[model samples]
Target: MTAGSNSISPIPVAPVGLSSRAQRFVEVDGIRVPRQDFRRHRDGWIERGIPVAEIDRAADFQDRWGGLALPPAPFYEGGPRILNAGCPKGSGAEGWSFPAGAGRVSMPYGFMIGPDGAFGIDAHRWTPLHAGTDGWVESLALAAHATRWARTVTRIRGRAVTSLDLGGYEPVPEVQGVTDTWWRGEDSLIALYRGEAVGLDAPQCLEAHVYEGLDEWGLHGG
Candidate 1:
């Protein structure tokens, strides 16, 4: 759907592989695009001289999709809250950081685009959430997609999570990250851990939510 001069269009059905029930689009520059698209709102990054190269790298996907407005899941509230580009902390040798959003509590940490073109959380240190912003977006999309089709969602916590034998599950490449990860099996999907644990330097906070009873369509929506 498109947006007019005065009125924003109603959110259209999410793209085929995304979850329609999980997210709605937000208006950007009077154009209705997915909330994940941060293109038009990236002026702050440019003004800060955040290296065109770095901005371009993150924009590869941010231009097309913005962050998701997902339901409460793990450490985040309303998913990764999308924000305007800003260098809350001045750019350093590590490179310029554009504040993306924050966790549910909004304290100690928030998301950002780090120097090496990675999308990560900034707290005690920069903890990479994904190799790139595109990965983060893909991760959210997958989560919503899987949850929508899963018959049962089982959330597990603590040491028990690390013990799950994912013998038949394959890692989901789109949602690539060390601490937080997604795995897919024949009839189920496993979302392991949340980045907040690592970002906040609290390993004990790890958790996993399993989505079971998903068919091929659910696993990989068209």
Candidate 2:
């Protein structure tokens, strides 16, 4: 690998036991080029059995691929990441703030309207219910963001929601030890949520059903 005046350029060499098409493409000179090009220029690093990390770094650059820079492909299989749906747990609503980690929220056993006008603890996930059909959600502007991350449940005894697990489709470079970093959404909403959670005031278009037999606090009945 040789460093250009601006960006890191990999010397082109022939791919080892691999065809050119199979190799992943990375941005070179503002254009997405194949891995074999690097191999052809770099003296067959693959045949030399160089460290994989070096090869990977050469293939992927930070400016073109990392930071807030737009990704070449959709980060996740589904859509953008939804940070705020505009629904607030009701007034006098039990609120709990968790550290940047994984855990589930158990609320009083009752239905509540989420900020996004959908039912259930996760308005994003239940969008289909409010949309009246899966097709509607499929066409939503931010449907990709809602569908990619796993659903967060209101019931305490059910599965938990971890930010790490509900990550973008393709892995992103970790920022400050954070797995999910990029903020992709409507420009205005993204601006509103700059490094902080944003809330929206929309109609309670759907019912957030609570699990039965649970205590007032969204916990399983003892």
TM-score of 2: 0.15
lDDT for every model? 0.61, 0.22
Error of 1 at 144 (Å): 1.7
Highest TM-score against the true fold, candidate: 1
Worst 10 residues of 2 by lDDT: 189-198
Q: How far off is residue 120 in model 1, in Å? A: 1.9
Clash numbers, per candidate? 6, 23
- Return the lDDT, model 1, position 151: 100
Clashing pairs in 1: 35-66, 36-65, 36-66, 36-67, 37-65, 37-66
- The alpha-carbon lDDT assigned to residue 26 of candidate 1 equals 23
Error of 1 at 63 (Å): 4.3
Structural RMSD, model 2: 21.0
Predicted candidate 1 versus true structure: per-residue lDDT over 1-222, tens digit per residue: 321123334443343343332223222111232343345545876786656666665554343343323344444554454432343344566666666655556566777777666777787888887876656656666766777799999988877877899999899876656657889899999988657677887767678889999998888773
